[model samples]
Target: MNALVQKSTASLDALKRIHPLMPWFASFVLLLPLPLLALNDYQIYLLNVICIMIILATGLNIVKGFCGQVTVGHVALYAIGAYTSGVLSVKFGVPFWFCLPAAIAVTMLAGALVGIPSFRLEGAYLALATLGFAQSVEIYIRVTNYLGSASGLGGIAPPSIGNFVFYDYFRYYYLVMPFMLIAVYASFAILRSATGRAFMAVREDALSAAATGVNVRRYKLIAFMLSAVYAGLAGSLFAHMVPGYVHPNNFTVIEMVTLLLMVVLGGIGNIWGGIIGAILVTIIADLTRDFYFYQLLMFGLVIVGTVLFMPKGIGGIIDRYFVSKRFVAAREKTAEQKRAEAAAAKSGES
Candidate 1:
């Protein structure tokens, strides 16, 4: 274990020496061949979904994990982004590039509105507020015929450059990959910045954070807005993908619950954990489709077990391993120092 950790540390150091962004570059290079390695088109599609989920889950981690704000309305922002993009592409004849930015802008406004309630509420109260927003968005989409209502909007145009179009799964993978990497990199950057520290301060204790000169309300709003950018991006990508269809059913309570599970299972507030959780959950959910009702039951059991026995989730375990390694090293150092003192005393007496 020590050897592995040392090797990883050395690799990270080497990467840092090369460039601050070398790790991200390496990650992108590693993922570049994934679609080619897939055995089938379906697997390639799954890769796209995983990338989208990573963006969404990482956004959620920013708010819930970093800022300690509980919100269920993230799906509503996601829905808004999807519908915004779909409407622009279908109803207005806008290209995907324009639609994408429009979707993110709208979601950012909605995110601010969602964050308004956080000033006065926390925990379940805040969750309920967000839940209400989520349900409202879902219901609005279901009843509004222009938005396609229950039937859903379709015939959205694929992204293109000149005559080249991202109409196939293979082409679409490239479209999504760079965005996913940027989102992940942005999250890590935020986590290491002054804004991220302010967010953690607010999460740890808002009152104390205020006392320490942190503007709790402002940071909370920033967290929500930043996270909303990711949701909007993911939703827009989904909206303009192959066959281009989005239903209100996709943003239901169950979907929100599943998103939450990604954060929880990955380790809340952990960037890599959120990414890992998104990948695992996407694959697990896909594989369990054959289990029917047993699938949901299994998910429930896993959630319960995770909360009860693994509250910190997989990421936490990874953290503990490194911590334990450091502790062992410190212990050995102390022992060696004590032995040196004893040897010195014995030599002096001789």
Candidate 2:
């Protein structure tokens, strides 16, 4: 098992050495045919949903997993992004291109506001603060007529490149695929960067990080804003897809819980785990659509089970295996060196 992991890791490293982005390039090429390979359009739609969920999960992982911020308001940011894009396209005659960035900008500002409470609050208090923001957003959208409150906002313009329009699920998949890959790629890049290290430091021990000259509040706010970017991008993508629409019901607490399920199931701080969790959970959600009544229970059970049995998540197992392999190899080397010295002493005496 260790040999297999080592060999795979080495191969990936070699691929990186060949070209840093070779793996991503390969992944992109592999994913390009996914829509064609799907059984039907609905499957393609599921694939798109999976991509959106990946962005959402990855964003949550950044704040909750990396920065250790307990936030339940991420869906609200997503709601803001979708609604912002919807309003812009429907009311302002704006293009999807403009709406996309506009949504992100709006959500980014809202994210900063949501993060303010984090400056003084921690744990449950911080969560409550964000939750309040989330509830407010949802309720406001639900009641406001101009925002298409109960009826939902429609007529959202799909993205186009002059003649080509992403009007179908198959075509739309291409639109989201690149962004999803970019989000995942950027996430890994951030994890390897200094800012990511600071976030983790704060996650591990905020006091210690601050003592080491890390600006806890600034990083905390940055983390929230960054997470919001992903959420906003995902929301915009969803809003601009075919049959473009935005609804408040879609951004409720239930959605947040399911999003949380993805992060927790994937393993909080593990990037690949987030991707894996998104794929698995989205597929499962589709398969169990008929059992909607029990969905939350299942999610709850899975989370509790994962936490109890696999706290670090599925990726953690891989991390531990490598650590153990290195430890065992080091011990064997030390033992062999001691045996060599013992043999030399015996020969000299003899």
lDDT values, one for every candidate: 0.93, 0.91
**What digit string (tens of lDDT, one per residue) describes model 1 on residues 1-350?**
76887998889889989999998898889889889999999998999999999999999999999999999788999999999999999999999999999999999988999998899999999999899999999999999999999999999999998999999889999999999999999998999999999999999999999999999999999999999999999999999999899999989977887888888899988888889999999999999888867866777777888889999988899888889888999999999999999999999999
RMSD of each: 1.6, 2.1
| Regions of model 2 farther than 4 Å from truth | 1-7, 329-350
* lDDT for each residue of candidate 2 in 1-350, tens digit (9 for 90 to 100): 76787887888898899999988987899899999889988999999999999999999899999999999888999999999998999999899889999999998998899888898999999988888889999999999999998989999988998989999999999989999999999998888999999999999999999999999999999999999999999999989887998888899877888888888888889988888889998999889999999998999899899999999887687668778888998999999999999999999999
| TM-score per model over all chains | 0.96, 0.93
Clashing residue pairs in all predictions, respectively, total 0, 0
Best by TM-score: 1
Global lDDT of model 1: 0.93
lDDT of 2: 0.91
